[model samples]
Target: MSATRPGSVTFVAVLVYINGVLNIIGGVVILFTRDQMVRASNAGAIAGITTAAILSIVLGIVILIVARGLLSGSRLARGLVTVVMILNAVSGVILLFNFQFFSGILEILWAVVVMYLLFTQRANAFFASRA
Candidate 1:
């Protein structure tokens, strides 16, 4: 438990922060343009878009909080992030079936890289020391 903080942790933290910010922004944008999306998709009601926007914003806040915990080397944060990444990867795969090929691939790759970084020897040691 004597190793210094690994670069992987810092890298993941930064990526998480960026992801959080993007999620929030995307949610807001989608919320504001709900009318357009509903019309374009011929979805009639705006209920679905509204729900998605809200969920995105909530997810963003949670991610931001987890990123903060991660920087501090919290074990719970690592677990939480791992779960989130797995969920994201699953969602990405689902999205691929819906024609979101580029984003889906990116999400899966991001999850894999984050998982690899988090479980590395140096990262594990860093978290152990913080405990």
Candidate 2:
């Protein structure tokens, strides 16, 4: 690890790892518990559930790979994570219109804080040093 590696970068990497694990777990749960959902007997419902499960699992795996890249100070990983956060923040705005006031606000704020941490002066120096 570079001596200049920022703590925020490390923290973000860990968070990403956790997020990846959770996504994978959520996907598997959807797969296993699909049968308990309403209208699960319907073939359409089953197919939908299966699709969601597969997508979630695939996303989780990709996130895990991103997390690893971030730990290694890969600029590509940072860019990927930034894009994901931007999308997350956008979702927050969408959530707000759906009557999820608190969740929406939290998500937006979370994204802001994360971006701030990732782009602070010390963090910039740290990443630049790696470059």
Candidate 3:
């Protein structure tokens, strides 16, 4: 495997860590707040929370896989990161409309961080080096 720069590895690792934490928090909330969540489910609150939890868990797995790929100098990880960032941005925009009822700001921040990390010069360089 080609060696990636320390900075690039660090950035991707941080993103992976964030995704993992979000997943854990989401799962805990869903499992612990079942009654409260069920009550708000119909109003979109519970549904939203459940969806977010599932998505977070999925994303966390993806992040871990991509981080491993990146560290191993796989170019596919870069493309995956870009795609994930775009999807996240789109999701954030959709969530913004429901700002009053959700963690809209956190969604926006997550999108921003993903976009920034994926599009930065370091990320580009990392991919290029792998190529």
Best by TM-score: 2
Which parts of model 1 have CA positions greater than 4 angstroms off?
1-3, 39-44, 88-109
Stretches of candidate 2 exceeding 4 Å from the true structure: 1-3, 38-40, 97-99
How would you encode candidate 1's per-residue C-alpha lDDT over 1-131 as one tens digit per residue?
A: 26787899999999999989999999999999998766765664688888999999999998899899889999999998999889989988998999999999998998899999999999999999988
How would you encode candidate 2's per-residue C-alpha lDDT over 1-131 as one tens digit per residue?
Answer: 55467889889989999999999999999999998885756989899989999999999999999999887877788888888789989999999999999999999998888888778887777766678
User: lDDT by residue for model 3 over 43-97, one digit each (tens)?
Assistant: 6776677677777667667777777776665778767766776777677777778
The ten-residue window of minimal lDDT in model 3 covers 1-10
| Cα RMSD (angstroms) for every candidate in the order listed | 3.8, 2.1, 5.5
lDDT, residue 6, model 3: 56
- Residue 101 C-alpha lDDT in model 3: 27
Ranking by TM-score: 2, 1, 3
Which 10 residues in a row give candidate 2 its minimum summed lDDT?
122-131
TM-score of 1: 0.76
